[model samples]
Each structure stands twice: as structure tokens, then as C-alpha cells.
Target chain A: MASTRAVLIWGALAVAVIVPVAIAAHSPLLAWRSPVYIAAGLAGVVAMTLVLFQPLLVGGYLPGLPRPRGRRLHRWVGAALVTAVALHVAGLWLTSPPDVIDALLFVSPTPFSAWGVIAMWTVFAAASLAALRRRLRLRPRVWRLGHTALVMVVVLGSVVHALLIEGTMGTVSKVVLCALILAVTVKVLLDLRTWALLARSWR
Target chain B: MTREHATRRAFLATGAAAVATLATAASGLLVPARAQGLAPTPSMRGGANNYLPGAPIVERIGGGGFWMTGSVRRAGDGAPLQGVRIQIWAHTTEGHERDPHSHGATLTDAQGRFRLEMPQIVPAFGQPHGHLAYDDAAFETVFLRPVMPSSRDTSLSADFVLQPA
Candidate 1:
């Protein structure tokens, strides 16, 4: 019975995030837009939403998820985040190559473009560094510091970018999601007690 | 997990989902189209016919902003066709679709050359594209390929080769 209940809870949590985004996408302004553009925009929203999941998984905050399983899922979700970002950029590129190029070059006239680009590269960099962590033989403390720093960049940049773009995303839902993402991330960082660990090690 | 704990978890999870859904819906969040099987139109379509017949002719060359250069030609003969009318409409720097300054036209020179200057437009979403059209006496209205912005501050070029229809 408990196991069944756990499954129910997990399902509900997933639905909560998805249903809102699905409903928020139905705007009259988007009626005439192309599928490629829609896909690009949706991918960005998904990527930003995924940020909320990362901290939860890493902190083992989800009910019934073991730490090991949560960590594994965290890695998988991080990779998925990268793929979403790629698809977001690729779909946009298909719709307009010049605009994509400008965003990538950090010369786009939109303020959101630069922030989005920064978050995108930081996500890629974080993933690459994580993959090389074992090979690089870095100390856990050093790795944690670098990874935490990049995560902050990803979170801050993504939040700003999403907020600045007054596009199809429903403003209320977007703000709520962003706020949750920031709160969860900060909570996870505090739970890690990285500073405490570093200070103890130094002593 | 114990039966009691499981029940509590389920209750909390269900409550969370319900709250989120209600809040989002109350805030007017509605997804219009499903993601799958959308029949997307090609990016380039005909330019908007917003050009007034007696609209004042504007010389786009040497004006500020991005410069666009192109030539009108006969499709089959590869011959430069002079005096073709080219129309352009683009989003403003603020990304407004109804921008007045972004809509205008110019006539091809003796060498079938035309130039247009436009502001650096940034779309709120998707990609920014400039609409274009070419008109010649002997050919059907030719909509030139869209003029897109690039990474560098450089001139954009397009050539309209109109087919007789």
C-alpha cells in the first residue's frame, strides 16, 4: 500500500509541472506561429523547468527516492537538460539562422539573448566538467566548488532570460516556476554545507 | 516505507499537484496546441502588400543600420532586369510587428541593383525575419527570400530571379 502511495505521489508531482506548462502554451498569439518556433520556445521552457528538478533530485528531497537513485537521476536529468538546450537552439536556428548566430556571438539586440547564451554554455561546460571529474582526479572539495559555481550561473542566467522574454509563456506561471527553481536551488546548496566542510577541512 | 508514511506521502504529493494546477489555471495558463503532428509552413512567404501605390521612394543606401544589397534578374535568361520594384517590411528594434519605419520600398537602378537599410530587430521569440518582394513588368510578383540578421555587423544580400508564370 505504501509503495502504491509513493507512486501516486510521484505521478502527481510530475503532472503538476507538465499540466501547467501545457495549459500555458495555448495563446491566440501563437496560433499562427510555425511548429519550429513553437518547439524552440517550448524547449526553453522545459529546460528552465528542469532546473527545478535538479536540486530536488540532488538533495534527495523526493519521496521514496533513495540517495543513489536520486543521484543517478540527477545525472540523467542534467544530460536531458543539455539536450533540451540543444534542441531549443537548433529549432531556433532552423527558423532563423541569422538570429541564432547573433545570439551565439553575444551581439543580439535582445537582452535575454546574451543571458540565455551564457546559461547555455555554462550548462554545457558543467556537463563536460562532470564527465571529466573522475579522469581529472580532482579533490571532491574542488569539484564541488566548481560545480556549484556553474550551477549558480545556470540558475541565475536562465531565470533572468526567461523573465525578460515576454513571449508566449504565461507570465504568472513563469514567475512561479522561476521562484520555485531559485528556492530549491538555494535550499540544496545550503543542505550541502560545503562551506562548513571546507572550513573544517582547513582547520 | 510504512503504510502510514506512504499514505502521507501520497496525500502531500496529490495536494501539491492539485494546488499547482489550480494556481496555474487561475492565473490563465492554457496550452493552445499539442506538440505533435503540427503542419508547419515554410519560413519564407510572400512579402506583405502594405506598400502604398504612391508611397514616397526612399534611398536605403548609406542610411544607418544594416545594409541589404541585391539584384533583380530574369530567371531563365540570367539577364539583369532594371527598374524592378522591391518592397521590405521588418520588425522594429523593439520587436514590434506593426512598425511603420520598418516598411518601405525602393526601385532597382540601371544595373538591376537595389539597397535597403533596416534596424537591428530582435524578436521576442523565435527568429527575426525581414519580408521582401520584387516586382517586374514581364514577370509575376517575385517575393525575394527573407533577409535575416547574422552574428557580425555586415551587409546582407539577396537576388531575385523571377520566373515567368
Candidate 2:
């Protein structure tokens, strides 16, 4: 019975992710949209989807993978997520330099631009911190606190950015992905018991 | 009342009317001229179509085996729109955005259905989005459709219902 329940849970998770993506694949706003823009849009979506996996991996939610393996995968996935983000921004830059410039400056007229930039920076910061953790000789607890905080910023900003952009991404799928990202992130953070260390640090 | 005052008043009124007319004309020019019907914005990243000027404007391709099928219909009446010229292009299976084999155009049949036989596309940008354009300039054009990849067959299908022009 327990195994059956686990299978059902995993099945639900897969459906939650796949069904939305399938729906998104069905309706693209334009039939002849430029490949570059399509690529950029796809990169953004891929990056956002990767956010969901981060929590799953970190929380050891995947059945076969042990927590150590999950952590290793989480690191690799994080790198992939960052790469996706870079490609997204770079692709957009190639398509429209002026818009990318405006977005970078945080002066783009589009509301979504600001959020995207924020998310982009946060992701970079998280990656940078991860790379520097050993060099900085930071305590594990301290590192966790900072990393967790940055991850939160990344997820929140990304969610807002994705939600705001009325682009090629199917609306229902994008929303479901964003909601799951937030929910899973929160759940993983709670499960990791980061709060206890963070709270104790305050004293 | 006085002849001089009446003439001055008439001149001022005529000047005001002329200014108003000029202002209206200027504002009309300032308003962005929309394309006939609803035309979607072009892709920012110039794709294969942008570079391939020598390519055929309309190709007699898209039939069987590996294909993309769709129907164009009137949104309100549920009527199929026949003879609508539809252009389509995608990244080739090898993932070249500029591949010629992935580009073509055809007309919809009487049933408002079109079948485009394209290469087994490898989505270079993550997921493949096939670019499309309708022949009628007066109807609003839908730009891109995310063509779902299938493992079982090298075929995909989509339907377009156009808004009233």
C-alpha cells in the first residue's frame, strides 16, 4: 500500500509537469515567429521548469536517488539552469539589443523586463556564491543561509517574471509551473530545517 | 456692429478653424498604421525565411508520412477557410535553423485543411515552433505554433480559427 501511494505521488508529479508542457506545445501565439525569439522563449521556459527539479532533487523526493546523489544532481541541474538563463538573455540580446539594454538598466517599459532582470541577477549571484563557498571558507550553516536566501529570490523573481510575460508560453502551463516551483521550493526549505539554523543564528 | 471689428472677428475664427484642421491631420499621421488585418510582429531573431530570398514563395509540398496538418476556420461560423495560403518553416532534425528542407508554403484545401511535410525537426531553441503565415493579407495572421514532437510518428497537427477581419 505504501509503495502504491509512492507510485501515485510520483505519477501525479509527472502529470503535473508534463500535462502543462503538452498544453503549452499546442498553442503558440504566432505561426511564423522568428526562430531566435522562439529559442529565447524556450530557454526561459526550460530554466523555469528546472526550478521545480531543484527542490525535488534537494529534498530527496526522487525515489531511486539517495540524498547524496540528489545533492550532486541538484548542483549539476543548478548549473544547467544558470546556463539556460544565460542563453535566454543572450538570445534576446541578439534579437533586440536595445530592449536587452533597457532590461539590464531596469528601465524597460515592459513590467516583465524588470522582474526578469532581477531573476537573472539572483541566479548569477547564487551560482557565484556556490563557486566561491570553498574559497570563502564559509561555515556550512552560514553558506546555507545565504544560498537559501538567494535561491528564494531567484525563484520569486523568476515566477513573477514568467507570470508577467504574455509571450509564447502557454498561460495555463506557465502558471502551473510557477506555482509548483514556489510550492516545492517552500516545502524543500522547510524539510531541510534551514529555519532552525537561521533562527539560532539570530541569537 | 462696426465694420472693422466684424472683419477682425471673422479673420480670427477662420484662423482657428485652419489650425484645428491641421492638428487633426497631424494626429492622424501620428497614429501607427496597422497592417491590413491582424499581422503578428515578426520574429526578432531573423530565421531562415529572412535570409532565403531566392526560396519559392509557395511550395507544393506537405502531403504524407512526416507531416504537419491543420485547418483554418472562421472563428464564429465554424466554416473552413479554403485557398488560404499558408507558409511554414521549422528547424531541421539536425537542428539547423537555416535548413532549406524545413521551409515551405501551401494552400489550404476546400475543407480548410493543410498538410505540410517537414523534416524531422530537432528543436534548437528547446522546443520547435513552426512559423506560419496566411495568404490573405486582409485576415489577421497568426505567427507561430509550438509543434509538439512525437516519438511514435514524425507527424504533428494544429488548427487555426481566425478572427473576423
Candidate 3:
């Protein structure tokens, strides 16, 4: 339950960070009609960020942490993230019909849109794998490698999409998001190293 | 070969495999643009197909005004459009309406020529209280209000090119 609470809190925080930035970028305050765009952009950023961090948070890759009290929290958080991402895409589609169409068809004029769409698909792939991993009878090593690869795909695509956007959030928000991504990546790498060392020592 | 030699060879192979895996992972972290380039410059055809002329005129009132001229090409293509209408309205640097006019509208000619004549710059919102900077442009901070032109115009020219939707 505490783990679930933590995930919910983190997810909300991510949304809060993205909303103001989106409003500033889309300049919804300038016109009421533009609110939809601002909302969608904000939602997209929040969802992408949550998805990027999902694996580490679920896998407990923090430098020092106890195992989550229950798997239920992890499941709830995963479900919520999925919901958020769906809404994000839907909002984007509504706000920019042509761009969203181009992105879906992989023919967007901007590469960043392509990256965002690819990230969405990668997130879907990860979710699918999570659903099937237990039943697939795959080796643990193989599963870990594949999951890590997909997660990286999602993160890379998201970072590119975020960095390319020019809006009110501007460079400051982007830099902060990038730094957080790097920090999370370093933590994951260190956790992997620690696990490998433990396994080797045991052997 | 001694057992020690076999052990060393196995260790080297394992190390090489690990390194290869890490390299692959690192490569995966790059956005797809590294291979495809950052953005596609709009081709003439792509821009031509989406071009709408006379669609961007903000308004046309029978009075003294300022004529702002610009072209609207598809971000995907660079084609001159005809008959797009444009509506131009602006607020003063302080965010007040320029003409005290409620709205303005106009149409582009076959050459996508648009002229907006305004009596004066009105505060758009209220008044410019302070500096408004967008993407690090200070002087570019003048308050410009925009809305999509009415759908009647075939092509649209905007006083300001909107970021591609």
C-alpha cells in the first residue's frame, strides 16, 4: 500500500510539473480556446515521463531501497500509467489532427513527432511483454535484456520529443527532465552492476 | 594448452560479449533522428498540396491601416497558394487592442498577396506590464493575438506563421 501510495504521488507530481509547462508553452492563457492543446501537451509529457521511469520504479533499482511491500502497488501504478498515456495521445490527436495522423503513419514532417509516436508504441510493447512474460517460458536473462532494451527505446524517444518542443516551458524544463533521466539511468546501471557482482561472488 | 590458458580465453570471450551487449544498449538510447536526420524540410509538392490562399486575412475595414504581408506554405512543402484568407488583429505592446476594433478579416489575391490596414496598435489583453520573452526573443515580445481564419478562404496566410500543428 505504501508502495502504491508512492507511485501515485510520483505520478501526480509528474503531471503537476508538466501541466504548467504545457500551459506556458501552448499559451492557453492567451486564448481560452487553446486550452485543449496545452492540456494535451502537458498530459503527453507527464505520461511519457512516467513510462520512462516505470521500469526502474517497478524493479526497485534505487541505490538503497527495500522491496515493495506488495506487487499490487506495482500493478496499480502500471495500470494508471497506461491510462495516462492513452489520454495523452487522445488529447494530442484532438489538438493537432493532421500532425497526429502523420505521426501515426510515420510520415510526420518533424522527426520529434515520429519519436513521440515511436515512444508510444514502445511503451505498448513493454506493457505487452509484462503481461506475457510469465506465460512465455522465456529465460530470465533473455527477458531482462529484452525489457531493458524496450525501456531504453521508450526513454530515448521521449527525451527527443521533449527536447525538440519550443514552448513556454522552454529550455529550463527540458534540461531538468534530461537531468532526471540521466540520474535514473545511472541508478539503473549501478543496480545492474551490483546484481552482477553478487551473482559472480555467489558463483 | 594448459587449463589456465583455457580459463583466460573463456574470460576474454565473456568480456567481449558483455561489451558488445553494452554497446548495443548504448546505441538504442539514441533517438531515431540520429539515423534519419532531425526534421524533414518540406518538399515543394508537400507544401503545395496543403497550401491555402486567402485563408489568413484577419479583417478588412474601410479605413486607414497597416498592411502586413506574408506567405503561408505547408510546413511539409513550399508552394505558393492562391485565394487564402487571413485575419490580422493585434494588441499593443501592453496587451491592449490596437484599433479598439472588435475583429478584422481579409482575403489573399491569386498571388497570395494580403494587406492589413490598421489605424493603430491596440492593447491586446490590457496593457503591457513588463517584458514578455518567447524562446529568448525580447523585442519579439509584442502581444499578437491570432485565431484561425474563417473556412471560406481556400488558402490561408497568417500575420505570424504558427508552429506546425
Best-fitting candidate, measured by DockQ? Answer: 1
- lDDT, residue B154, model 2: 73
TM-score of each: 0.57, 0.54, 0.52
- Give chain A TM for each model in order: 0.90, 0.91, 0.72
Best-to-worst TM-score order:
1, 2, 3
- The true-versus-predicted C-alpha distance at residue A145 of model 1, in Å, is 1.0
Look at candidate 3 and tell me the lDDT of residue B2.
50
TM-score for candidate 2, please give it: 0.54
For residues B1-165, write the lDDT of model 3, one tens digit per residue: 556555777999999999999988888786453444324222211121111222233444334343345553322233344554444444322222222342355555665555665433321111111111011121121122222133122222233222233
Number of clashes in model 1? 7
When candidate 2 is compared with the true two-chain complex, its DockQ is: 0.03
Clashing pairs in 1: A23-B30, A23-B31, A24-B30, A25-B32, A26-B30, A26-B31, A26-B32
Ranking by lDDT: 1, 2, 3
Model 1, which residues run further than 4 Å from truth?
A1-12, A197-203, B1-87, B91-165
Better of 1 and 3 by TM-score: 1
Query: RMSD per prediction, one decimal?
Result: 24.9, 12.8, 21.0
Looking at model 3, residue A129 earns an lDDT score of 80
